[model samples]
Target: MTLKICVAQLNYCVGDMPGNAQKIIDAARAAYADGARLLVTPELAICGYAAEDLFLRASFIEACDDAVNRVARELAGLKGLTVIVGTPTHGNTGRGDEAAGGLRTKSMAVQQRHNAARVLREGEVIATYAKRELPNYQVFDERRYFTPGQGICVFEAGEGESAVRVGLLICEDAWFEEPARLTKEAGAELLVVINASPFHVGKGNEREVMMQNRVRATGLPLIYAHLVGGQDEIVFEGRSFALQADATLAGRAPGFKENMFQAQVERAQAAIKIIATTEPERGDDAELWDALVLGVRDYLGKNGFPGAILGLSGGIDSALVLALAVDALGADKVRTVMMPSPYTADISWIDAREMAHRLQVRYDEISIVPEFDAFKASLAGEFKGLPEDTTEENIQARIRGVFLMALSNKFGSIVLTTGNKSEMATGYCTLYGDMAGGFAVIKDLLKT
Candidate 1:
C-alpha cells in the first residue's frame, strides 16, 4: 500500500484566521488533485505560530476554531484524504470558567488552550494531539500560554490494505523522546510532526541530526513539516523532511522557502519505504542570506510596513544591513539617511553616498553638527570645565536618531536599527540613539 503525503510549507500571518484558512484549503485542494492521501501543514498553521498574547483573547481562540472548522467544511468532500491542520484549541482539562461569555464553547475554558494539531476528515475532527513539551528557554515562551498535552494521537488513514497508521506531534513535542516513543509503541507506522521552529546558523543541520536520532530510536518513518515565514523577530526555515527507520534522508524540502513537498510512503511486505526523495542543494552562507532576506520581507509585509528606513554609517554593520534591506524590501522601498558628526571622516560620507547610489534607493545626508553643538552648549553651564567624552558621541548618535525617527513618523516607514553583537555586548551603542528603532536586523548575530 502506497500513501502519498503532501507537506504544505506556508507563511501564515498572525491573527489572520480567514486568510490562513483559505491558504490551507487551497493547499488541500492542490494536494488532493495531485493524488495525495494525506496533507500536513506547519504547527499553528490556522492562526499562525508564536501569536504571543493573542492566545489570551477569547475572541481570538473562537475565531481560530471557527476558521479551522471552515477549513474542515470546505475540504470535506475530498473523502479519504486526511488533513492535519495546526491550531490552538480549548483543552478538555482544567477547572477554570470560560474567559468570556459566548466566545468559546460553553464547557471549555479559554485558559485551558492547548497548542494542538487537529485531524480533519469528512467535515469532522477525528482526533487531536497537543504539544506535550512546551519550550520555555531563550526565544521561546510557550509555557506561558499552552498547557502540555497528555497522550498521543495515532490514527489510521485510508481503509483496508492501503491504510497507514499516522501519529501526530507538534513542534516541541518532537524534541523529547517520550512522545515519539509512545506514539511508535501505540502502533503508528509513520509519524507526522508539524513545527514552527525558528532559524539560526546551522539550525537545519542540527534538526536533521535530531530527526535521525528519533528515527533510529522509534524505528518508525517520520515526516517533519516546518513553517516558512518571519513573524516579528523569529524566522521559520521550512526544510520539511521525511526519513526512513534506518536514519536515511528519504525526502526533503528546501530551507527558507515556501513549498508543497510530496513523498510516497509505501508499506511493503517487510517494511515501509519512501519512493520519492529529493534533497535540495545546501550551503551555510547561502542559507544565512536566505534566512535574513525572508525574515525582513515577511516581517515588513505581515506587519503592514509600507517601507523601511535605516541610518547608513558607511561602516560594515550598516553597510550589510543596507544591502539586506534593499534585497528584502527592494531598492525603491528602502530609504537611507547618512548623518555625519564633527568627527566623521570625509571618506565615510563618500562611501555612504556611493553605496546608496549603487543601491538606487532614496538617500539623504543630514549633518548632526548643529544638534550636537546645541546639546553641548545647553549642558555647558552645568559642566563648565568638564572635558568632552562619549557623552558627546552619544549626543551625536541621538541627533541622528531624531532625524531618522522624524522621517519615519512623516513617511510611515519602519526604522531598521543596525547594531552588531559586539557593540551591544560592550555597551558601545546608545540606548535611545543607535538602538532606537522598531526592529533590529542583527541583534543575536555575532561580529565574526
Candidate 2:
C-alpha cells in the first residue's frame, strides 16, 4: 500500500500567532487536496520559530496553545488527513515536595515548556512528541527556553492493511543516533523530522549527510521538513528532502523558496520503499546568491517597507548592494544617491552615475563639501593645536549620512547600508555615517 506525504516548506514570522496558524491551515487544505494522507509542517509553525523572550510570558504561551487548537479545528474538515505541527507546550518540572506525614507528594507538573510536535486528526490532538535533545551552541538556544523530554513517540497512520508507524522528531533530536534507534525499536516504519534550521554556507549539504546517516542506522525511511524565510539576521533555506532506508536520496525541494514537497512511501509486509522526484543540486555561489536575495525580499516585505534607498559609491561594495536591492525590490522601488565630498575623484562620479543609469533607478548627486567646510570651521577652535587628521574624513561620511537619512525620513523607504563584514570588523566604517541604515544587507559578508 502506498502513502502520500506532503512537506510544507513555508516562511513564518515570529509572534504572528493568528497569521501563522492561518498559513498552516491553508497549507494543510492544499496538501489534502493534492491527495496527501500526511502533512508535516516546520518547527514552531504555530507561533513562528524562536519566539525568544516571548516564550517566557504566560500570555504568549497561552496564545500559542490557542493557535494550535485553532489549526486543529480549522483542519478538521479534511477527512482521512493527518497533520504534524511543531509548537511549544507546558511540561512537567519533575520536582515535588514531601508531605508533612513523610509521604511524597505528586510531582509538580506543567510548569516547564517543551519543544513539541503534535499529531492532529479529526479536530483533536491524538499524540504529541517532545524534543529530547536541546542544542545550545551557535544560534540555537533550545536549552535556555525548554526542558528535555524523555521516551519515543511512535504513532500509526492510515488503516490496518496499509498502515505505517511513523516516529516524530523535532530539529535537534535527529542529530543523535539514540532517538531514531529507540524509535525503530518501538515499531516505527518511518521517521519525520521537522526543523527551522538557519542558513549558512554549505549547511544544506551538511543536513543531507546527517539525515542519510540516521536512515542508514535505523533502516527507516526519513523525511525532513524545514522552514524558509528571513528573520532578523538569520535566514532559513527550505530544501526539505527525503531519504530511503538504504540512505539514498529520495526527493528534494528547492532551497531559499517555499514549496510543497511531495513523496510516496510503499509498505509491503515488513519492507518499505520511498519514491520521489529529486530536485537538481545548486552550486555554492548560486545558493549564496539566492540566500541574499530571499533574505532581502522577506526582511523588507514582512516589515511592511515599500522600497529601499542606499548610498551608491562607485566601489564594488555599494554596487553589489544596489544589484541585490534591485533584484529583491525591483528598480522602480529602489533609489540611489551619490554624495561626493571635495576629495572625491571625478571617475567615482562617472562610474556611480553610469551604474545607476544602467540599473534604471532614480539617482541624484549631493555634494558634501559645504557641510565638510562648516564642520571644520566650527571645530577649528577645539582642534587649534591638533593637526588635520581622520576626524575630517569622518565628517564627510557623516554629511553623506545626513543626506541619506533625511531622504529616508521624507520618503517611507528604508535605508539599506552597504558596509561589508570586513569593514565592520576592522572599524573601517563610521558608526552613524555608514551604519545609519535600517538594514545592513551585506553586514555578514566579507570582501573577497
- Listed per model in order, the count of residue pairs whose N, CA or C atoms clash below 3 Å is 0, 0
lDDT of 1 by residue, 35-68 (tens): 9988999999999978999998879989999999
Q: Give the Cα-based TM-score of candidate 2 against the true structure.
A: 0.95
Estimate the TM-score for candidate 1: 0.93
Question: Candidate 1 — which residues are off by over 4 angstroms?
Answer: 92-111
* Residue 16 miss distance in model 2 (angstroms): 1.1
